[model samples]
Target: MSREPTRAAILIRESRKRAGLTQQALAEKLGITTSAVCNYESGASFPKAEMVFGLCDILDLTPRDLFECE
Candidate 1:
């Protein structure tokens, strides 16, 4: 099975796509840099814990959705 951290990154990327958001757009909403979003989607980095809820809101995902990968 894939690790939760890796799965979280994939979930975030897929959720963002489903929401019709570009990295720049999600970054704008999160008040972060586009490169940060790129890094997250690329599995280069993870968001801070406090940022996860906001990310979920913007991506139209529940926290469970981000962590439920197999």
Candidate 2:
């Protein structure tokens, strides 16, 4: 079955590409390993609420933008 993309997944990808950041680079910014970033992009895991703030800060986005569920 096909799965719809979650907002977190979409935001992770869009922000990374817009910033010209490789997965490794984004992981470094978030103080995580590249595998974590890869998982986030692949929709295998979700960031915690606190981590969401950090992600927004790093990606230059607001929580609303990242978590929008429509």
lDDT of 1 by residue, 1-70 (tens): 5334477788888888999989999999999999998888877787887787899899888777766742
* Model 2: residues with Cα > 4 Å off, grouped in runs: 1-4
The 10 consecutive residues of candidate 1 with the worst lDDT sum are: 1-10
lDDT tens digits, residue span 1-70, model 2: 7566677788888998898899999988888999988778777787778888888888888888866843
lDDT of each model, Cα atoms only? 0.82, 0.82
Q: What TM-score do all the candidates reach, one by one?
A: 0.80, 0.82
In model 1, where do residues sit more than 4 Å from their true spots? 1-5, 68-70
Residue 45 miss distance in model 1 (angstroms): 1.0
lDDT of candidate 2?
0.82
